[model samples]
Target: MEVLIRPDADDAARTVAGIVHQALAEGVRTLGLATGSAPVGVYRELARRHRHEGLGFAGVDAFLLDEYVGLPPAHPQSLAEVIRRELAEHVDLDPARLHLPSGTAPDLFAEARRFERCLTEAGPLGLQILGIGVNGHIGFNEPGSSLASRTRLKTLTDDTRRDNARFFGSIDDVPRHVITQGLATIGEASHLVLIATGPHKARAVAAAVEGPLTATCPASVLQLHPHATVVVDELAASRLEQQAYYRCIARHKPARHRY
Candidate 1:
């Protein structure tokens, strides 16, 4: 795993956008996307590049990380609508190629199974962009989620719901469940890029990067991935015990290396 500590969130986003640009240059065709405050800057930076630098997503297939179970498709706060407004509308990515979990599927369980089957049948993701929850969860796979889990429905923890309440207006308004790609499902991606920021994320970042690989901190599953990059601002990297080493490693990385 590679840890990159940038000066601030915008800097980290730009650096991540560079990595995505390199992947696109290398012909990456499938992108796994995340939605949250942590990754919004990255999407915005990518959009800016698309508008000004000729960067494009015309041929890319985007797969969203998760969706709330009870939200309607048109709900403004729904992950689907969020991605559409924040990314799809701003990029050249074909709408027909974008895939999001069916939050309102009549058979939600079947829908989850179908999504996993379709993902694996299609092949590994070119890249998976991620955002770490304050509690160290990835997607909606909260603490205690099985390390080898697959796409499935999961109940949202109170902590997670509370964190997301800002978008829904109140804690009680937040969706209680969601459909998320599992850790094992996410692990199938050829590359994993996790973005996190702020002092509030420091402990989670440290636990993910330096703590033991355990389901207690679900994001720690990245440690088992062959290619994983953890991008964060200095504030988020504060709790990492090997902060100096991480900085030195990033500083010495070959200029041409993507991550």
Candidate 2:
């Protein structure tokens, strides 16, 4: 994996946004999007490009990473709504093209199958955006999730619930479960870009970037991807053991692979 330590969160976001913009410019149509504070800046940067730079997403199709199981479709905290508010509303991306797993489906298992099928039919994602949770989870695939798991229902861990509770009025309002794209499913993307920032994410970023590839840290699975990029701010890279080496690698990146 390529580790890029930017000066700050905004710089990290721009680096990620540049990768997405380059992909779109190269005619990549499908995208895997993650929702959280980590990716909010990237989304805003993309939106700015769309408005001022004429960057367009006219025919692009985006698949969200996950959604809360019990939240109403219109719930402000729902991943779908979060994406709409942060990214879609600011660009030309069609609402119909932004696919998200159904959180309120009566038969959630069937919904998982259907959403997986939908993802398969849409063709391989050109890029998948990710955000690492404090516990080192990706999507909602918490610790102990099978490394080879597929799209499915997953119970939220207490740590995850507490982390997300800030989005809701209270911890009690947080959903207990979520439907997420598993590690195996996420690995299918042609390019994976994980954005992380803030001091709170330092340890998780270290585990994911340099720790062993175990199910205990689902984000660590990125280490196995042939084309994965971890863009982090200085605070998030604080715990990485090989920070100097990573910086050297970034500094001497070939011109053809500058993005």
Candidate 3:
């Protein structure tokens, strides 16, 4: 993984925004996307660019990494709606091109298979955006998840649900299961951009960037990707073994070294 330590979260977000714009210039349409706090800044940066920098997302296709099971698409806390409110609505994206995991499908297994088929038809994704869970889970691929797994329905760990509960009105309202793209599926993308920020993510970010390639910390699977960029802010890089190199990089870009 190529680690890029920015001055702060916003600088990291701008770096990601530049990558997104480059992808668009290359005629990219399908985006393997993720939902969570780490990526919030990225979405905000892209929205700002779309509005003030004369950028657009008219033909971009969005595919979420996962969605809570049993939640209606209209649910305010659903990934579908979150993406819509946070990013889609703010841009000129086509509604029909927005692909979300069907949380309430009658036959979930079939739906999972169909999701893969749709991806196949859409052609290879130009880039996949990811956010590392505290437990190192990527998408919903929890610890011990096989690297070869595909899109499927899986139970959400209590820790995961609790972490997500902040988005809902209460902990009781969060779903306990979800369908997500597997490690193998996400790793298949042409480019992988994993954004992590804040001190809370230090341990996980360290594992993803410098630890062994293991399923225990699923984000470590990023090590196997051909082209992966691990972007994190200074606080999140606190636990990294390469902190000195990161400090050196930041020193050169004083404007980006906010913290």
CA RMSD for every model?
0.9, 0.8, 3.0
Clashes of 1: 0
Best by lDDT: 2
Q: Name the TM-score of candidate 3.
A: 0.93
lDDT of 1 by residue, 1-259 (tens): 8999999999999989999999998899999999999798999999999999999898899999999998887899999999999999999999999998889999999999988987887699999999999999999999999999999999999999999998988999998989999999999999999999999999999999999999999999999999999999999998989988988998899979845
Clashing residue pairs found in predicted model 2: none
Give per-model TM-scores: 0.98, 0.98, 0.93
State the RMSD for candidate 1.
0.9
lDDT of 2 by residue, 1-259 (tens): 9999999999999999999999999999999999989899999999999999999999999999999998777999999999999999999998899999989999999999889999889878999999999999999999999999999999999999899989997889999989999889999999999999999999999999999999999999999999999999999999999999999998899986786
- Model 2: lDDT equals 0.94
Candidate lDDT (C-alpha), each: 0.93, 0.94, 0.85
